[model samples]
Target: MAGAVIVHHHARYKTYPGEVTGFVFFACLIASVGGCIFGYDIGLTAGLTSTESFLILFFPDIYRQQKEQVIKNQYCKFDSQELSLFGSSLFLSAAAASLFASPMARSFGRKWTLFSAATAYILGAFLGGVSTTFPVLLTGRILLGVGVGLCIHASPLYISEMAPAQHRGMLNILFQFMITVGILSASLTNYWTGKFIGGWGWRVGLAFAAVPGSVIALGSLAIPDTPASLLLRGESEAARLTLQQIRGIGIDEVKQEFDDLVAAAEESKAVTKPWRELLFGGKYKPQLTFALAIPFFQQLTGINVIMFYAPVLFKTMGFRQDASIVSSVITGLVNVFSTFVATMTADKVGRRALFLQGGTQMIISQILVGTFIGLQFGLSGTGAISEQYAMCIVLFVCVYVAGFAWSWGPMGWLIPSEVYPLAVRSQAQSITVAVNMVFTAFIGQIFLTLLCHLRFGLFYFFGAWVLLMTLFIAVLLPETKCVPLEEVAHVWRKHWFWREFMVDTSADARGAEMRKRIALEMS
Candidate 1:
């Protein structure tokens, strides 16, 4: 927060620099392709349910038995538990990869770690495509998860640091917007390829993930390393040169800015601090608590529950297989468009209102979904959802997705990165995201089974996810919009005076010596 002020000296400013900002935007655009890869791989998993390659890879015998028994449309059938494992393996392993990837990323330069991840990503995709058996396919998914592990951390970090501070929020949010785009791309790809070419089209879709994953890996080689990170590693001259190259600033200006950032980074070391210290320590415990809890609550909406099993859901809603996959494409489109609005408005709208809107709408949507399901059974008195009332069910679920895209989806990535301090940022971001994916794994499997066995009953679980999320958001959510990342902990601190200055607020405080230490360090 201390060095957040953007200095634009007229004397230092030359004539209009045509497309300088454009080039920077392009660089970030290319670098963030990893986000698209992450989104595509994860989002495509559900839609892949419509693909025969996915089925053949998991159910070789189903196809063979169909040849012998002539079971007609039931060629790909599997037990609920078996089907659940096949669908959920990708998320479960990615969650595991995310947990360890966070700390290692801090030590490794962001670019190199991502490169390593890309190799794994590419290999995973190829293997997943050719996998003849279940174990191989599962292995492929785990490897892809390793690649995603590095990307989910490094991609956003790269965007934030490379971006100008004034525009950082939206630019960083663009990473998530790209995520929506990737998901949409995957869903549409799945729909068209599966419907037109038949279910085996997943081979093509799985192969497509490799393209962006490879681009990000190669692209990382092109960009200069982040100046701040170099400064942290004692490569000050190199850091200054990198900053000048990227910022187009005079040597003196860049040097002064670099020193100030490092100085503040050092001072903030003592405040409840961000990330690792920010979440775990005494002063930052509450802020950290909110930071951790928000993501926990975000996933509870059972959003992934829907995403991972959307095709299965649409089928239950009474669509044929192809129609169901096409509907998933529509959901993907809604997700992409809504995220675009969020990227534009999050900073302009500020954080509090969006967070509130997101949580509140989720609650409404889930309750309505449950109500619609209950009515379908109660009024129709049959397991089938009535055709007349179907629109309401689809629209409410769409509204829930829109709310999430506007709020939690992008904000999940934005808030933690912004709220945490420099040192702990990587560590904490990794843990928060890891937990998000871990739960996604657990719930993703459970929800698919529930949808089949319980039918309309699946909405009840989501309704509960919404209820718990609402209470957590209402009570624990912090207003982080416009708050500089470095100083978020200071405002959120609970110790009366500590709340004021992020240390002992006044001489009367118990930790006066600690306060003095922080004050001197700050000065």
Candidate 2:
């Protein structure tokens, strides 16, 4: 069967020829620009909302009242509801846009979908940068949300399809790393702009999103559509050529891969079902469950809460405005660096292990953070928190970010891209991304309000979820370390106990069986 042949090729072509490798790297890098935009949108608001200059220009009444409170040595306050709306608007629009991402990708193809998304980002950035009213700015954010939805839905799918099985995890995870880079870039931009430009800092910070959006729009032209998409469209010869050019292997090797892809494509067509059947029917029940569960658990980790409000969280812990913004930058740095760790190790350590290890650590970090904040509130009330205790909270928050970066941050996108069959990959990915955005919006919308009331208890709420996530990953997620995409369907069919704990050997057996089945069909 082609699956067996693919496994043999996996062993033989441990590294792609230089040109193929370069093309794959370039393609993934270009697609990853969407990730940078996603990060920037998420990170920009953290600083923008915290900037007094921004507040004075947009929310003068709250800014003036806060200033008076500051003058009286009382804690300054902003409208929590307004801030929540400001942060959650993008996710709201993103969730709505995600509903259409699958159809767009399926109808127009991944490359064009990304190009359109980049265009949306450019328009959104322009609107945001020049907004004279809050509604205009919110509308701009809603536009960016459309772009974010398309990009998040398409980028990882494109990368996963293009990348070789052995390197797919790392290459796809690169999207998350780029997101971290974007966050870090936004954080630095906010710091410099806030320090110098004051009132106009957020506008400049937001406008910078257009730079990467432009890069993606232009750079996408250099890459071809995925062979899988081509095969789906019955362009077998074109798919063959693409596999040849991107793989840079010998004729026999290229033919072998082409055959495997065609076999998978044929199988997909044979079993093609409507979206209702694909999602709810027994044939794809496991895949659908996995697709939905992973993204749901990913958001439950409370990572977005921190990304959306890190500076404000720091301020609540007693740091000055500038210091809190600086602290958020540090968190961005940790996020970027730790995502790099995930990129390097995702293939090496396997997805399931990282999920388990990272979830455990996140649970601990959240608990500790909750404890420190609780002690500060209980012991000191409105008095100054001890510097040591404040530092502890910051450290634990970094730990929590590191845990999320190395696990859910990357795997949440990567796993769905791999697990589903190519036929429904786009649709499944759209559903999963929508799930992600829904939870992100829910958390982002209420986090500030929660902080107003729950205060340190918010950490406890997140901690409880992390514990559940740890159990979920340990008990459910099958290891997909080096399993070829064509054969991943078999991974879900194994017994639940084996899927949880003994996936490596089971994947091998499943791959062999898959190969035999394809061989029989071909004969």
Candidate 3:
């Protein structure tokens, strides 16, 4: 009976001890709170900007005389450019801060990097919550953006390094899942608060972001830095100890993995490429392009349009203020649930397949949304649609959200973190994430303005980009399921069509050959 019980435990938990898995899980969970904060900030603005009390308090110029009307239309006095700036401020700040993330992560280590981020979050939330004027509130959001930039850049890098290979994809994607949860939480909070707390509710919601940031800051202290970071710092013994703790195994058991990590670190150090090499030098051009393109396409899919302006979209679809908020909540729920699907299936089904499938679905959904809205409202914007038709627009928007949640949402972070070489991993990730934030800020800044000017045609613009993104993935993205981090460069080098672009020089060819040989021997 004891033997049988032991066998069952082995079957269920695999090689790691239950305690070790639990520890790793706890660490990752705490780290993921940063993602939750990102999501909360995104969702908070969507509902807050549409709330009557928030509008009156912050933008009295826009709120005057329309207070008795439905909340969605109450801010008609504000132009598109003003609304865009309000939504884009956080992302703009994030983009600026992302440029410095690599230096911070390399110099201070991942755990402390995240701790600093949490501190920024706390300060930003406090400033935002207490602000009486627009500039002060914008300043608070800028600080929050700095925090978001650091946390988003570091969280997945830490997770990918620490997690076991078999569980890595799921664990890494968990960061994205936490983001969806934060969005849902914020949406629900805004819904309830907007209904009950009057104008002060938005302030409370914005201030509440500090709670999770505080948790992440304190929790980061308990988790050790990644093994790779320690090795990079020449702290071999400390790296080994951290690996032992994370793997829940003894020194002997972790020896092989530790050796592999050290070897990879040494190899990475041997090729000391400057940051400019990632752009101007041809050595890392493929990786640099892949890193930038994936995240850029991710934003172009128009997912943030829904994330940042769901209530506004719903109003355009002809829903009432309360109904629009409720519909937005439904989209948030779908986003959270679909991300769970991605987390469970990422490793099993592979990244490329999900991207292809999800991209196709997103394209179709966007087309349908554009068609329905255009048909109802007309190109010149002089028609009205029935409630039934408006519901169709809402349904398709939910579908697009689901498609994105499971595909680009998770893969955007996962692929970039895994594909870059260890030496340039932090720098490459920062670049990609910075590019992501740039596009996010651009979209957030212009989406409402486009809606006013383009009306139903706005969906068509995004649909076209979705179609282009699908083609881009089908052509360039390679499957990276279960590939060792050190061999990721080989996967790109081995691509059937893009091999020339990825393998530019004689040294790269030799390096790729050597990595392939090593991968075979390890297998």
Top of the candidates by lDDT: 3
Across residues 221-297, which tens digit of lDDT does each residue of candidate 1 receive?
77766655565556668777776676676665454445544554445333343453545445455546655776687
Cand. 3 Cα-lDDT: 0.80
lDDT of each: 0.66, 0.79, 0.80
Worst 10 residues of 3 by lDDT: 1-10
Residue-level lDDT of model 3, residues 163-239, one tens digit each, is 77667789898899989998988888888888674468788888999998999999999998999988887889999
TM-score, every prediction: 0.83, 0.90, 0.90
Residue 324 of model 3, lDDT score: 80
Task: Please give the distance, in angstroms, between residue 93's alpha carbon in candidate 2 and its true position after superposition.
Answer: 1.1
TM-score, predicted candidate 3 vs. hidden true structure: 0.90
Whole-model lDDT for model 2 versus the true structure? 0.79
Candidate 2 per-residue lDDT over residues 70-120, each given as its tens digit = 431112234367667777889878888877988788777889889999999
Q: How many clashes show up in model 3?
A: 0
Point out the worst 10-residue segment of candidate 1 by lDDT. 9-18
Which pairs of residues clash in candidate 2, taking residues 3 or more apart in a chain or in different chains?
Answer: none
